[model samples]
Structures are given as structure tokens and as C-alpha cells.
Target: MLIFPAVKASSRLPATSNNLHPEKHKDLYAVTEQVIARAIPLWNLSLTPVRLPLVSNRIKFKCPEYDMYLEDMSDSEGPRREDAKMSTNEKSAEKNGSATCRTSSNRNLGILSLVSVPPHLEDQYPIEGPRELKPDNTVDIWREYEEDGLQIIAKLANIHLTPEKPEYEGGTWHVEGQLHICASAIYNYDSDNLTTSRVAFRQQSNVQRAELKMSYPQGDHDFLEEVFGCEQGGSGVQDLVTVDNPEGRLLTWPNILQHQVQPFNLVDSSKSGHRKIPALFLVV
Candidate 1:
């Protein structure tokens, strides 16, 4: 069994005053979309949750320039200090202890600092895994079989990309989409002598809230073989299973505003210039 831990989001670019220009904002959204797209493959393979640590309650966003300041809160002090000492060695020890405390405090605070992004964006970056299975003689029918089974589970996890708010003509935009993903896969092998089964559970936040809804749930022991692009009992099963599957799932946004845009004609002079757009835009 193998275990891959979650990777935290680390890149933080200082917010420039002019970063909110229409073109720049569009670019930011595009980059965000790309990140979501790229992350799908990774999510599918790991069978773990993707947690984007960009959002925090302590940070607030102000337009024009995104200023991030730490919240003002008092720190608690422990019990009173021990007796004072004037010895040379004691003084040196105190100085070293203070320095170490400061260093540790700085490190912990740095980790707590949150990265700020446009309010219209949201993401769930997935954690990766090939989590190790326990050793048991009854279940070790084929070492390669167990390995291959895990590889397929990871691959399925990588293909999904959660939707985000779409870019529009106006400066204001809202992200109101919710993504719910769940994957459960099991591998079982049974014969006259021994029987074994390995199960994996991968679930994501489900944002759908309505009376009627549709969902996709797919799983099979054979899916592992299909992901490896091999047939059952084929060669290289062990090596292929051990390899990580990094591709995530993909999703397509519906064309919800198709009729809103007027058709353009080459010969029509009245349609050449841009028209006044409406204030309220709704996507359902």
C-alpha cells in the first residue's frame, strides 16, 4: 500500500493596483480555469480530496488594490517565568532560547498567512495517494494485481474539473456553481482456496441543492485493467499498477446564454457597432 499526502497551494503574487483592469481580470480568470483543468488529472489518480487553501476568514479583499492585513488579536502568555539568574552561562542560554522561540513563531505564522485572489474564484485542489494496503498472505494472490487495482482508482480521480464563474462583459461577476463528486471502487478476487477484496472511497463536496438532480456513479474491477490499457491476466500488471495515474476528470459548462446574443450579419450596417448591454445577467 502507498500513501500520498496533500500538497498545499504555495504560490502568492503580490497584488498590484492595476491588476483589476478588464483584460488583466480576464487573464486571471483564464489562468484560474487552466489551473482547475490541469488539476483534474491529478485528482482522478490520487483518490483523495483536493483542498485549495486560498480562502481564509482572516483576510478581506478591497478592490483596486487587494490589501491583505493580519487580523488584530491579542496573544496569550503562559505562566510566570522562573527566577532570574546573572551567571554568564545562564544569560547565554536565555538569549538562545529567545532566538529559538522567535524563529519558531515566525515559521508558524508564515504557514497561517493566506493567499488572496479575486472573489469570483473557488477551487478544491486534490490530494494524491497510492495508499499502502496491509500485508496478508490470504490476499496476496498476485502482488501485481493489487498494485494495478490502485493505479486505476487514482486515474479515475484525476479527470474532473469543478466549474467556476464565467467571465462576462461587466466588471462585476458572481460564482454560484457547486460541484459534488463521489467515487467508490472495489476490487475482489475469489477462488476455492482464498478470497480477498480491496475497497477505496473518494468523495468531494456536493453543491447541488434541488428537488430533481442527475448524477454519475461508475465502478468496476475491470476498470483497473481498462485504465492500464491492458486485458485481464496480461503481462506488466504489477509494474503498471504500481505506477501513479495523474489524469483528473473533465467537465463542460452548459451554453446557458445562447439566445442572449444577437446574430451578426455581414451586410447589416446597424449591427456593426456594439449595443448597450443589460445590467442583470442570469445563468441557470
Candidate 2:
């Protein structure tokens, strides 16, 4: 009988090469490098330390006082607190008949109290009273936000940004680059954590789009925790860094850094809350 001996399944298995699972053997490092190439220029720019403060590149923090001041005076609204103190001062001034000017005693005025401090103390008041609160004149407030953004960017990029006068020629200073501004309003809704690790732009026919991502400074993580009230540590998902959304704060970062904003929910359903952000990108 020339019957062949029965062979075990293990012995019948064919020899396989190192790439047994070709699908799982993808070059992830190569893919990451290719993705990062999109942001190489900007990354280099952030590092290249151009000592001009001609533009702002920083993240602004929550200015509750500023917000309160703006909201109060918005639409020419009157202060809820009766300016009894101001009235008293005015009555005293009139009784004294000396154009009396006393410092503002209203604690609710926030940073607006600075207006009381005279520039020359020669009775030549620039901000005479609360009525002089013009939004345009509040450039100093905007400067605070600008400085905040610059500070964060300086720390991240390991560069010093000093205020420098722009080069002037002919009749105007020569400024290089286009200012790209984008504003987004976030209400009581959640958004997916979108990474701004790479620069992307697209245009087709009539449609045009550009996107930039900003992240808060690492030192502000605790502040984010307090604001977000996230009891849990780390992102629930692994292999990701947790950061709070810039949320009305002016934030700037190299396009190479990965960042994301956690979903936020309002504590009070009866009241409305919103986070509005306006970002500026300088493209040369």
C-alpha cells in the first residue's frame, strides 16, 4: 500500500516573510514627517527671532473686568450702581466752586479707574468722566491683549520680541505681509478637537479658505482646569495632550505643535453664555 502518511496542520503551514501583515507595517514616522512638512516654513519663522514688535503674536487671557466694562457701557447703558459717589463729588465741587476732581472711588470700574490718574496733573484731563469712555480711545486695553499674545509666543519660540519702530521711507512705513483675521463664535455647543499642527489653505473657483490653530500656554493648564471644571486628569483618550480652547483669548503657536480644545458645556441652561475669538495671522 503506497498510502501517504497523514501530516499535521502545523507541518503543512507555508513559510512566510517578515512582512506577514503588510497592512500593519505602515511607516507611521514617514507619514508624520510628510504631514509636518506643511508647517515647516512657519515653524522656522517662529524660531528665526525677528526683533520687531511691529505685530503682536501672543495669547490674551480672560479679561472679566474689560468685558464687564464694555458690556456696561454698551449701547450707552448707565451703570447699575447709582453714581451717588460721583454726584456727591460733583456737589462738593460745585459748592467749593474750584472744578474739583477727585479720584474715582467706584470699585466696579475695573481698569477704568486708571483714567482717574492724570497724565500731567495740570487739570488737563483727557478722560474727563465716564462719558468719555470711547471704544476707539481704549487702545491701551487692546495693547494689553496684544502683549499677552506676544509673551506666550516668546516663551514658546524662545525668542525676545522688542518693540521697534518700522522702517519709514517716502511718506509711509513699509510693512511686509498680509494680515489674515478670522473670527469664530462658540456658543453652548461642543466642537471636535481640531489640530492646527500644519498650515492648510484651499481655493477653488469662488470658494477660498484658510485655517490656523492656536493653543493656550502650558503654564495655563491649571487655569483651564478651573475654567473647564474637568475633574479627570489627562485626555480620556491616550496619545494626546490636553489643552483648553483659546476661547476669547489671543493665542499663537508654531504650526508644528499639535493642539486641541476640549468640548465645553454651560453650567447654567437658563442663561446664555458664549466664547468669541478673533485670530490674526500675518502671512508674508
Per-model lDDT? 0.24, 0.27
Candidate 2, residues 63-175, lDDT tens digits: the string is: 11122223445444545443334456556754885333333334334331223322354254334442233334322212332223211100111111112311111112121
Question: What TM-score do all the candidates reach, one by one?
Answer: 0.14, 0.20
**Which candidate leads in lDDT?**
2
Superpose all Cα atoms of candidate 2 onto the true structure and report the RMSD in Å to 1 decimal.
25.6
Cα lDDT of model 1 by residue, 1-284, tens digit: 11112223211112321224445565643443244333333333322211212322122221111112223322452222233224464357457743211111112221121224432442331122222332331222123232332211111111111123111222222222223222221111111111111111111212222101211113222323322334444442222111111112222111111111112222233222222211111111
Clashes of 1: 30
Sliding window of 10 residues with minimal summed lDDT for model 1: 152-161
Candidate 2 lDDT score relative to the true structure: 0.27
